[model samples]
Target: MIKNFHQYYVYILSNKPNGTLYIGITNDIQRRILEHKQGLIDGFTKKYGLDVLVYLEMYHNVNDAISREKQLKKWKRLWKIELIEKENPKWSDLSIEWND
Candidate 1:
């Protein structure tokens, strides 16, 4: 027997350190981030220029990813900043190398 696995991502995008933030969930982080960077998706992210991939969490279950995304979205700005800084001290774009 064979089993297949699916990946989901709970990601955070920001314009700069302590700047506007966006929380989202997607199965393809690369493609999703690319779309945001290209302004292909309209709304909050595009309006605020939150294209930098500042933080991310991956899971095999979509529900888990969605739950995490929603939870993060409800978090206070300072808490979110600390979460990002814990993993990304300088708030550098984690997807900077994916320039396309």
Candidate 2:
């Protein structure tokens, strides 16, 4: 039951690995992450502070997903931060319907 025809997505949220990071794919990106920020997900995202929409890349095909993920994974901490800042300078949560 995926929506928008976007079967999945490749996203990067900065909390930390197991500490706060949220790397996942979903058709409804905005809604899914909003759930995380609201502590809706009873997992690592809630335990840590991984509620920020640090970085996100869209892909029409899964191969792009695999490639981009691998690229991001190898990036340095500063590099990751820069990438997020490029689009989300404030590090604000881009999740709509998600309240602070």
Residue 30 lDDT (model 2): 75
By lDDT, the best candidate is 1
User: What's the TM-score of every candidate structure?
Assistant: 0.94, 0.67
Candidate 2: segments with Cα more than 4 A from true spot: 1-7, 15-21, 38-43, 97-100
Best by TM-score: 1
lDDT of 1 by residue, 1-100 (tens): 8778899999999998899988999999999999998999999999999999999899998889888988998999999999999999999999987656
Give the Cα lDDT of each candidate.
0.92, 0.69
lDDT of 2: 0.69
Write one digit per residue (lDDT tens) for candidate 2, span 1-100: 8655444577877664223455666666778777877789887777776777666778777777877787877888677777777887776656533554
How many residue pairs clash in each candidate at the backbone level?
0, 3
Worst 10 residues of 2 by lDDT: 14-23
Error of 1 at 48 (Å): 0.7
lDDT, residue 90, model 1: 93
Stretches of candidate 1 exceeding 4 Å from the true structure? none
